[model samples]
Target: MAKVRALDPSKTASSLDTPTDLKPDGVAAVSKALNALLADTFALYLKTKNFHWHVSGPHFRDYHLLLDEQADQIFSTTDDIAERVRKIGGTTLRSIGQIASLQRVVDNNAEFVPPVEMLRELMNDNKAFTANLRKAHELCDKHDDVATASLIENWIDATERRTWFLFEASRAGDNSGH
Candidate 1:
C-alpha cells in the first residue's frame, strides 16, 4: 500500500493555485459572467423549490413534481458554474448574502398566489435565465473559452425546452387543434 500524505495546515485560501493559459483579464471576465449565472441559478432553484412546496390547485401533483424536477436541474448547474470559475483561475460565490447580492431573479414570499400565476412567473424567469445565459455564452465566445461556451449552449437549449413545457402547461385549452 502507498503511504498517504497529510495536508499542510499552514496553507491559506490565497495559497490556492490555478494555472491556465488564459490571460488574467480574460479569466476575470469569464469568471464574472459565470458567477452571475451561478447566482441566478441558485435564486431560481430556491424559487422553484418554494413553488414546489407551496403549489396547490387541481394540478397540484403535476406542478409540484415539475417544480421539483426543475429545481434539481437548476441546482445541478451551480457546481459546474463554480467549478468553471475556479478552473479559469478565479473565485466564486462564498455565502448566501453573496448569492443574493448577485442574483437577478425576484423572490416570491407571498402567502398565496394563483397556481397559474406561479407557473407564468416561473416561465418568465426561465426565459430571463436563458437570455442571461446567452449573454454569458457570448462573453465566453469573446474570450475564446470554448469549454464554457459549449456548456452554456447546452444550458440554453435546456432552458428553452423548460420554457416550452411551461408555456404549454399553462395554456387554458387545446388551442393547437383549432
Candidate 2:
C-alpha cells in the first residue's frame, strides 16, 4: 500500500481554498447553514449526555441507556457536517464560543429537571433538529449540492426517530416523584 500524506500546511491556507464547482455564494450559504446545524447537534448531544448522567427515579437504567445511545448518534454526525463545509471550500466552527453563537438549541442549566420533563424536552429538541435538517436539505437543493442534501436526509430521519422514542418514553410511564 502507498503511504498517505497529511494535509500540506501551506496548501491548507485560506487563500488556497478547496476546489469546488458550487458558486461562491452557494458555498457560503450552505456552509453557514451546516455550521448552525453542527452547533445544534453538539448542543443536543451535550444535553442528552447531561440528562443521561443526571436522570433519576425508578426507570433510571432504561432512560440512561437510551440517552447514551442517542447522544452517540447525535455526535456521529458532527464530523460529516463539518467536513462537508471544508469539502465545499468553506471553514467550519473552531471554538465552543462559536458553537454557542450558532446553536439554536436552548441550553439546560437547571439544577434538577424531572426525568419525565427531560424526556419531553429532548423530544422537542429532536423535533426542532428534524425541522432544521429539512431546511438545510432545501438549501442544499437550491445550491445543487446533492451530497450534503443526502446526508441531511439521513439525519432528518434519525432525528425524527429519536423524537419518536422520546415521545414513547415520556408518554405515560414515569411519575417523576409526583
Candidate 3:
C-alpha cells in the first residue's frame, strides 16, 4: 500500500486573497457557520450511508432506499457549501479530521441497531441539522449574506422534510404490527 500524506492546512490558503464586497468579519462568521454545517452534513451522510448498507429487517428495502436518497441529498449540498465559502472570500474545511473536529452530529458505529432505533436516531439527527442550518441562516441574515441565507433556507426545508419522513417511518402502528 502506498503511504498516505497528511494535508497541510497552512499551504492551502487560496481563499485568503479572494475578493468579496462583504465585510471580512461577516465573511468569516458565515464561513465558520458553513464549516459547521458542512461538518455535520458529512457526518450525517456517512451515518446515513452506513445505515443504508447495514439495514437488515422486514423493512430493509424501504429503509435502505430512504437512507440512500437522503445520503445523496446530504452529499450534494457539500460542494455548494464549500464553494459558497470560497465565494465569500473564506476558506473551507480541508480534511476529515477538520470536519470531525467541527461536527456536532454523533456518529453511530454499532454493528447492530434495531430498525426503529435507527429511524428515531436519524430523525433526531435531521432535526438537529435543521437547527444548525437555522443558526447559520441567522448569521447570514446578520451579515446580509443573502446568497448564503437563501441556500440555508432551502437546506432547512429539505432537512425538515427528512425529519418528518423519518418520524413517520419510525412510528409504531398497526401497519408495523408493533
- TM-scores for all predictions: 0.88, 0.89, 0.88
- Candidate 1: residue 155 Cα off by (Å): 0.9
| Model 2, residue pairs in steric clash | none
Judging by lDDT against the true structure, name the best candidate: 2
lDDT of 1 at 78: 87
How far residue 86's Cα lies from its native spot in candidate 3, in Å, is: 0.3
Poorest 10 consecutive residues of model 3 by lDDT?
A: 1-10
- Record all residue pairs in model 1 with backbone atoms less than 3 Å apart, i.e. clashing: none
Give the per-residue Cα lDDT of candidate 2 at 33. 98
Comparing 1 with 2 on TM-score, the higher-scoring candidate is 2
Ranking of all candidate structures by their lDDT, best first: 2, 3, 1
What alpha-carbon RMSD in Å does predicted model 3 have with respect to the real structure? 8.8
Candidate 1 vs candidate 3, lDDT winner: 3
Worst ten in a row by lDDT for model 2: 1-10
Q: What is the lDDT of candidate 1?
A: 0.85
- Local lDDT at 127 for model 3: 95
Model 2: how far is 138 from its true place, Å? 0.8
